[model samples]
Target: MDFIFFDADGRYFNFLCLYQILYKPVILTIFSAMQTMRWAFMLCTISQLDVLIYNFENMKELVKAGNCEINEAFKDGFKKNIVHHCAIIQFVNTIGRAFGGQILLFFMINSFIICTTAVQFFSIPNPLNNIMELVWIFGFLFIMIIMLYIDCYFGTIITEKGSQISMTVYCFPWIDLKQDLKKQFIIFFVRNQQDLVINASKLIPVSMTTFRKVMNWTYKGFAVLNQMRK
Candidate 1:
């Protein structure tokens, strides 16, 4: 019994040492590549956020006293728009969250298979090695996958919101049926008309400027996430 335990412990230590020898270079390369991707995603995302904030602040600077009344009018108009669309937003957001979860699960399972297969390739040098290699690969992949999704979402939202907000700024009194945004909103989202009415009631008290900001955000959020999924 003592002899068997001694052999097993020695083998475990040997495997540990082998892991240290083989692990760093390959794992570091993968990590470095992933880090580069994450950094690029972050830079793009941050640039978009910075642009949005810059434009929003610039718009704030341009506000005059007479615009305050227009702001109230906008508030009323935006309130109605939101109430008409709030339910639809809730439904869309719910679907988005559900689908996002599903996609994440798929990535996790897919990554697991890839890592498991990779472990087989790694074991060619010492075919009899135990399960520790797989554990490390999976641990590393899981962390990277999380990073991937976060960066992806950030990049998507910033770009989407930035462009959409800019467009909204250019077209404030955009109540025309001929306009693209209102047309789509009416067609795709106005199916839940009661939801829009309820949403507008909640939005009306906050002022049109506030509601417009939120609507812009919601619009951009959908656009960003949709791009990310693509």
Candidate 2:
């Protein structure tokens, strides 16, 4: 235990030897798991959206040839598709809900970490003494920002593709459909109009907008801290 808990000469080395080895690795693992889960959800959502879009394209192809008669089988298949899509959407939402609180906490803690690291890096006068500390802070800052960017980018993709599904439905020849089928299509379109947007704790929608906001906020906060330090 003494050997594992021993401190090094440099601050960064000490941190790496103690917290990094004992605690940071665990924290990183958890974050990695969350990130992987998020990526998986986004991919699944996109792939399912692709499937729906393909179905819509096929329907469009059928209707393009003046064949407006939608068979009973097609109607049934459409209904099943609706259910499948809703399930996928709901699953993502559930994932968001389950992890949203943790995500918020993660962002808050990371922000603090970045702030303190920046302060230490910029405030310290002796560069030789704290070179490792500078490198450590910079590395973490870069990695965290990159991770956030990927998260928001993928989230944006999910929403955009989900919204396009409704548009795909609209592209179909609805006017020529039988009255009952037309009614069903109308209902489906209306349902899809809601679109799929997974929010973090219902506060921040996980999209590029959030990414920009976070970056701006971090920068402003860092600037303020820097001024306070001076």
**Local distance difference test values of all predictions, in order:** 0.44, 0.76
Against the true structure, candidate 1 reaches a TM-score of 0.32
- Report residue 159 deviation for candidate 1 (angstroms): 4.1
User: Taking the tens digit of each residue's C-alpha lDDT, what string does model 2 give over 1-230?
Assistant: 34544456655676566655667678879868877887787787788888878877776666566565455434755777788787878887886888678666766766667666777678878888988877887888788777777778887888898888888778776776678888888998887787577778888888898888877777788899899888
Candidate 2 residue pairs in clash (backbone atoms < 3 Å): none
Candidate 1, 1-230: lDDT as tens digits: 12334454564767766666778887989866754653453454355445544543343443443454434444345444444334334543443343345434433454444444444435445544745765766566566445544534543553354345444444554353335556644443334332211111222211233334434544465455545545
Cα miss at 96, model 2 (Å)? 1.9
User: All predictions: root-mean-square deviation over Cα?
Assistant: 17.8, 5.2
lDDT score for residue 220 of model 2: 84
TM agreement with the true structure for every prediction: 0.32, 0.79
The total of clashing pairs for model 1 equals: 9
After TM-score superposition, what is the CA distance of residue 203 in candidate 1 from its true location, in Å?
39
